[model samples]
Each structure stands twice: as C-alpha cells, then as structure tokens.
Target: MKSLIVNADDLGRSAGIDAGIARAHREGIVTSATLMTNGPGAEGGGAVARENPDLGVGVHLVLTYGRPLSDPATVPSLVEPDGGFPVKASAVIGRGRVRTDEVLREYRAQLERARELIGREPTHVDTHHWVQEEPGVFTAFLELARESGLAARPLNDAERERLRAAGVRTPDRYVREFQHPRAIDVAALLALLELIAAAGDGATELMCHPGEPDPELERTSAYAVARPVELATLTDPAVRAKVRELGFQPITYGDL
Candidate 1:
C-alpha cells in the first residue's frame, strides 16, 4: 500500500499563513504541518492546531530566518552580529562555523517552544529553508531527531538512508515539485500524484507552502505570490478526488 503525507511548511509565519494552513487541512487534504515556533503567528497557529486535533503538527526548525529562541549570546555562531539569523541557507552554510552544539541548543529551544504553544509534543521535525540539509548542520539535526524520537523529513535519498541508519522514523520518499510555481495548478498536482503512485509502496511526503497573501508574507518571502495558487490547488475538490482515486492513503508523520 502507498501512503502520502502532505505537509504544509512555514506555519506560524503570519496570521494569513496560519489561516491558509488551517483551511487546507479542514477543507483540503493537508494531513500535517510544521510550525515555526518563533514566527509572528505562532500563538495563533497553536490555537488552530488545538482546534484541529487530527492535524499533526511538527517543529519547523529554523536557522536561516527570524530571531533565535535561544539567546544570541548563547548561539552566536548561528546568528549574525545583529543577533538575528541570516535570510538564506547559503549564509549559514558558507560560514562553516555553525557549531553542532549551537544547532542543538537552538533546535531544542524551538522544539520546546513548539510544545508549549501547541500544548503537546510536535509530531515530527523539519527545517525551514531546508537548513537541516546543510552538511555542517545535518549531524545535529539527526541527533535531535534521534534524541527526541520524533519523525523527520529527509529531503533526499541520502538523507533517508542516514535517518534509517540512525533508527529515526522518516518516509521512504520526499516530493517537493508540487510547490513549484509553474506546477501549482490542479493538472500539475494530479500529474505529480500520479508519479508518486507509480513510485511504488512505502510512504512519500510532499512538501508544500500554501498560504494567503499578506504584506508580511510578501515582504518576507520571495515565494509569496505563488502561495494562494498553491492553496487553491490543494483545496480544490478535483485534487482531493484525485488523491482518493489513486488509492493513496493520506497519513501524518506520527503515523509512520
């Protein structure tokens, strides 16, 4: 049997985003979401998660956006001189000085903050901006998942292999093409689903960033304009029907 986890990322970034994610889960096929514990809408996101108990929520670990939950003085290597994280993963990786200890400290803080806000432990862990994929930080990311016993999102085959080797829970495959602006339509989404169906057995995760447009999101995210389109496609009745037609079992990371 084939299973799919449609995980919306960047939750808690803004009220508009939180609204979109909640709508997608309530009215669409979104089975899970990853929360940005330090974001502007974090508290609101928590409220929504509580309201929708079946929506598995997870920590969207951060190192490349916003301020750190840990004190800047404590995780200095993960922050700039201004005490905020850099805007891009490249900046974090290029520094080559991101201490694993610092990654663990900040990630742990984020995880704890998520638990406090959501009123429960998160279902899993994944990175914002795919920051956990950075070689310098990947080890720390794995260590956190191993210690927490939380499932994780592995972006590639190699990461999946490593996660399995470490005895951490993760899906067998990861698919991110649906978020591509050009592919945010129903036809594209259906086609992508078809591909996953053919990839055979095990679980697959489709990373998505569906949200409503707001000034804050527009200002902070380069991919903001495409969000509503993604939201529309995700919640479209046809896409939902297609998912069922293809015999894909929708599940949460916790189910893995």
Candidate 2:
C-alpha cells in the first residue's frame, strides 16, 4: 500500500549532475532517472546506465533551454526563432505562440532520439522543465507516448485502466515543480508530504536533483548550491526513516 520512487532528473545535463545521480542511486535514495536527450555528457550517462541495467531510465522530454531533436528552423513552433525553447512558458502560453502541431512533431522527434541513443523506447516518460505539464502540450505529449505503445504517467486506479488499455504502466504520484531549495522549513516538508499523500494507491515518482554545492553547477543552473541540499536529503538518515515511518516502500518505473 505504501510505495515510492525516488527519481533523479536531468541525467545528462553535466558530469557533475550525472555523477551525483549515479552516486545517489548507488548509495542514497535515488531509484530512477529521466534522461535528457540533448544534454551534455549524455553519452557518458548512457554508458553508465547501460552497464547498470538496474537503473530505471526514462525520457525527460525536453522543450526548452536546449537543443531540439528536430531542426529548430523546421520546428519553429516548438522553440523561439533563435532555436531555444521559450524561457518563460507562461509568456508563450499567454501569447498563444506555442505551435501545438510543431510541438507534437518535435516531441515525436524527441522520442526517436531517445530510442536511437538509449537503444529502446524509454521505460517511462517525463518532461524536461515539466513542460509536459503546460496546457496545450500535456495531452498531446501523452498521445505521442501512447502512439509508441510505451508506458505513460499513471496517477490513479481509473487511469490504471487507461494504461492497461494502452498496455502501459501505472503509478499514482509524480514529483513535479521542484524549484524550491533543500533548506526547506517545516512548511515545505509538510507540503511535500501532502503532495505525496494525494497520490492514493499507485507509486509516486519522487523527483530530485542531487549534486555538489559548488560553482560548477551554480554557474550553469539556478539549482547550483541546492543540489547539495537535495543530496543531503537523500542521504539523510532522518528522511529515510521518515519514508519508513510513512509506510512508503520505494520503487521505480521498471518496478511495474
């Protein structure tokens, strides 16, 4: 009845990031990861994952701040004219500039990129930047994975039927919106507990990013020093004990 999956996102973003995920999975609470198709150190991450088949690798469908799987010029609707996905999704959604058709095409390309590189359709699907959660992009993104007959995000018992109909896997929870710092107050942890509890019967994809609190990641991501905090949380004996106290057995996408 109590199951959880501690997942690391942005696996190929950097050596530092990838190494942190590897270590978290190897020695901490990390149970799965979503790979960035256009990420740096992608090849290295793939090699490591290949060697460690135990790691649950899924596609972190990217739609912003990175290279597109399709030519940017061709997939203009998916990115800015300059080839980057929009920096602010709200502005794009507000302006109605998001070309859903182009996005669909580009997402398909992202899927193919995952297959070509990782040697198979991803075991599961998650979006980079949580872009799939965006309004126009959400259902269409799910359709793309459904078309490929791959497992999609499963959130409930009724949805479990949906996934079963599509021959996909189903889980109850996902960790979206992870921008907060690790030095969270009681309110933050309480909020997280609330979110996790909302996912009634299925598994939860507990998303996190764990890395060193150093200039290397700081210069590149807003999550710089925060990575160490995440690592700390994963390695935190107290937090692990809490999972046990809450009765959530950790799991991954491959567990289905």
**Backbone N/Cα/C clashes per model:** 0, 2
Worst lDDT 10-window in candidate 1: 88-97
Give me the runs in candidate 2 sitting further than 4 Å from their true place.
154-168, 176-179, 182-201
TM-score of each: 0.97, 0.82
lDDT of 1: 0.90
* Candidate models: Cα lDDT each: 0.90, 0.69
Alpha-carbon runs more than 4 Å astray in model 1: none
Global Cα RMSD, each model: 1.1, 3.5
- Give me the candidate number with maximum TM-score: 1
Any idea how many clashes model 2 has?
2
lDDT of 2 by residue, 1-256 (tens): 8677777888777777777788777777678887887756677667656755677788777777577878888877777667777655464444555677777887788777767666654777776665654556766666776777666664345555655676666566556444464443334544675568666666777778777555766876787677766776676666656666777777777776
